[model samples]
Target: MYLDINGEQFRILKAESQGAWLVSCDAPGPPRFVDQRELDAYPRAPAPEPCTAEQGEAPQTAAEQARMALIQPLLDNGDCVSDPAIRRQLAAEAAQEHGTTSRRVLRLYYQYIATGAVMKHKPRKRRPPEYENYYKRAIQTFYYSAKRPSLRDTYDLMLHQFFTAPDGHLADKRPTWPAFRHYFYDQAYHRRSERTIARDGLTNYQRTARPLTGSAMTWKDHIGAYQMDATTADIYLVSRLDRTKVVGRPYVYLAVDTATQLIAGLYVGYEAGEEAVMACLANAAMDKVEYCRGYGIDIDAADWPSKGLPSEVITDQGRDFLGGRMKELCLRYGVTCEALPPFRPDRKGLVEKMFDLMQGRYKPILRGRGVIEADAQERWAVDYRAQASLDLTQFTQILIHCILYLNGRRVLDSLQMSPEMLEQGVAPTAAGLWQYYAAAGKSALLELNPQEVYYMSLPRKT
Candidate 1:
């Protein structure tokens, strides 16, 4: 018997029955149970039969051979991993090897199919499930989740949200960070890297930051301070609110020594004004020498260093930076006050970079967690404004703390040295065993000259 299914015909009839309709697709079926009164009264559908393959119903003899030829490697090398190209080639080679002639591997693979001929395959070790899907999710989260997550962060996020646990387990078997990163984090590396060419925004203040010099900043022709500036750093808004409703108050100001690349001064530059810078300079002196925030080992308190002054103070020519009072103060102190032209912070590039590290790098991290609490915000403001009221006499003492602890303790990447490195000299390991021994003064290791240990390159264009 034959019946049509979706435009294809299948041989099917009643194969077996317990009642009413007798059925058999392949053979005679038992009689169906029926009421004697109306045994043949109702309409009946034919029972399904054991269908035999029509012309195109099954793969041709050649197709069976071809498929087997294609998949014979698992038979030979039980654990071999298959590449698509290699897999295809494997099939062709297997067909040749097995003597399956002139047919697709699928068509001729099973000509003499028998047991133990095909070996099974297993999933790859460290292979990701659905890599494209993970890529889309991880990349989207990385870009949207503020400042882009670090590679580790992106991986962690996926583990937390996407990966699932199977039932009957005591706890979910979370994949290790390495495994998660093998898929998502590494994929990001393939993308083009973001270019971060820094432009200097500082103005040239080589003319006369030195109130005491009273002449050309340098008698040497064209010899001037090479001021570099950078800006728009992320700064934590130290205030009473949970987070700022709008631009908040109390930002830390950090001015760095370009030549040395050490943070010269750091103060909670409240909003923006002369008071901010003066306060920062005070911090510089405090963090450098007079105070005891010794060299190395990562402790977190600020100290005051005695050496507070810089040869030049390069900054943007903002009103607060270049006002009469700031210029006058610079002249009095004999510090060259150089200002960059409007909008070009590159002139003061060193300090500008400090801003980037502070704002761009650190602030986003802190902000994401919402670190500033009410009491800290209050303390930050009170201390900042209070520093403003002190006269120059008192101001000097305040700056002492800021300079030694905060400014002098800063580490620099250029020389892999600390602010204390100049005064203390390089580690024995870095400058070499003897030099390290000399700087450390290990009795056997004689100490070096304070100035000579650090060779400053005069900023003179060589």
Candidate 2:
């Protein structure tokens, strides 16, 4: 005996004292026994009338005909259509015959079953948004401001400000909140940088919203171009003379080779300006073996191979880089000085990124030893200055190790290896790349006299 339960057809196989053994006629599964009491409790409904397709309203397009053909077998067998297992098997066979997925075949079957029209299988066209001009003007004027107003608040303000009658009464045909929100998000998505600059300010936009297109590898033909930049180390340092006195954070200057991504030079000190730049350049010109030895770090010359003067130095328009002393030194050494325009740190992104990479390596290990936490500026934050345990020399030693690790051991997955280098199975490390290129005589390193470089790098006493 067949009965419809909750819109699904089921067949009773046998009646027992306590329950009746039943199997679903609309879905495929093993026979299930239902309690006699529960069976009586279900409301009985006449089976739904079979969905029939309109006679003259046949499929018009090839896609519609194809969809109808895919679902025709399931429609022909009404009993199997109700049994999920049988239905799935039929759909899978149809899918394989038609070169389509079973899921797509099943979806077509359900679509035809519901509407009895193959045309319903086609996707509907998307309509363009009909946002009024006043709505967009209002969003631009009020929504994209430093005040950072919400979409709802902006809509409310627009209704009162623009969508009002001449006599100050609310207009009957104002834009809805839902429409305003949709339009705002649409505009924000399309004009992300503009929205960010207007709402969060230009600095925030430059830092987070600016589009990154080109890479520093654009200058990867040679190792002569060095990008120079300065940043204050996050950790506070104590004075070497007096361990009790907190000497504040040290200024770190790094000169990075664009082609090989090597740390060509570095300077960590309390001084800022031309003096620091000169000192860093002097270090870049001299051999690093003796410099490491001075810091009690014994290493092979090949370990820290980056040395000699760069052909061109790229820096931001800082007063130090723009000073006469810098110009004089660069002119004397025939080094091209390219100071980037204001608010354009993205031009020297390699050196800028290196600062973060170098600091991130050591900051985790030196946490309580004076590394400043992100929340150090917040109210009731820890006194990071008092936590200073590392002096200048100690911090320098740590920085040297970090630089050595980055140059010699750290793998740069983004580093583009030449065909020759790849053929030789060269490691994608800064030192590895530098050594490979230098050995090939493609190095742009100028072997300047150490004494002349040192004397020229010293601040001129007029």
Candidate 3:
């Protein structure tokens, strides 16, 4: 009978009794037990009891001895399952061999496996928490300060802010880092454990800020289609990677449009210079050029006028934004470029959101690769090491997969519409798109700068 050797209730496939020997002719492949509690991933079923040696009873037969030997290895090796339901079945099998009560043998066997001969699990006491808040706002005063905060940096700040004693001296000192490291650095011993996951009780994972706006988009956005900007944060390499073996230093770039905030182009490349920027733009434009055409958007295959280019090109005034070939290219195409103020990221909010996405989903991919450099030197270092060094270029292939997944995957914010869905349905041809822009009064807004890559922010605030 198909039996789950761990539970109280079990199936009996075949049974026969001889004196005290209830032999199971159908206990397939030496009895097995999987505790559903420990092995939640495996399928669970009811089980029967096993045979056992009784008090003042005769010895077992040769077949019973053979079965015991086969099962002994499994039990000793930590196999036969941990699921309680299945354990009962195993007990039933043992009982069948020895003609004893399954429940009794199971209880004794379980106790032996649980601790061998030690104490069982005991509950711990709790105490009231000291400080409530952890994270300080990103400034000391009203003005926007230039601050670079990392995971460790934030942790240190939170620790000090919370543990600062009122005495200021050494009277009744606070607990040390060793005492509290478990919450942040502890590994889960079991699934579904109610473990605290923040860094020293600081709620760093969740955003506690006000909300801002825009975009009519969806996940239906085709792989080669949508555009995005940097309302994003994780513009860096994967954070949790083994930096000793592999390292990364990437520049952030984002592509977005006014309506649905779909990331048309996303990349983690060497430099955030003009070349990277151009590559990103070109890559995005290339995708747009491909996916848009299939849906009938008027992307000029041969010639693109600046006014008819993108409805709007948004960015902040970084060194990468306002120089050399970048400005020249934009001017030549008549694309209206809008740059955010020096200290105001809110002006170009989408890219900020993009950075947030990066820190969460994409940073762990590059852990352990130290020395986050920006050139081929980094690749060479990995090659020279050759042992722990993984071929990053090869590793980067999954990034392309992730991009495709993000593009094709239905974006929930799309209100049930996909990016591909929007692009496919919007059938404006190139000339028509141009005409629409011109008719929309962008001619007055187009600042023809042959050399300037960025457009100044809001009339310079007088």
Give per-residue CA lDDT, model 2, range 259-346, as digits (tens).
8888989898888888888778877877889999999999888888988988898999899877877788777878898988778787
lDDT of each: 0.40, 0.79, 0.40
TM-score of each: 0.32, 0.72, 0.34
What's the lDDT for residue 342 in model 3? 61
lDDT of 1 by residue, 239-318 (tens): 33422332333445666544334454554433456555555544444434423333222323322212334446667767
Off by over 4 Å in 3: 1-247, 287-311, 364-392, 414-462
Highest lDDT model number = 2
Compared to the true structure, candidate 3 yields what TM-score?
0.34
lDDT-based ranking: 2, 1, 3
Per-candidate clashes come to 104, 4, 99
State which candidate, 2 or 3, has the greater lDDT.
2
Q: What tens-digit string does per-residue lDDT give for candidate 3 at 1-462?
A: 232334332332223232111112223222333343433333334232232222123225664344343334325543344344665666677777767677656544443332221112347644224421222231121111224344355445555555555764432444444434333343231111221222212232122322334332322121222233432222233333563543444454666433334454444455456655665565454434453444344344322222112434667787666656557765676655667556655555545655565444544664443322234265445432222343344334434444333434424442443364355453232222323334444333333331232332111232
What TM-score quantifies how close candidate 2 is to the native fold?
0.72
User: What value of lDDT does candidate 1 attain over all alpha carbons?
Assistant: 0.40
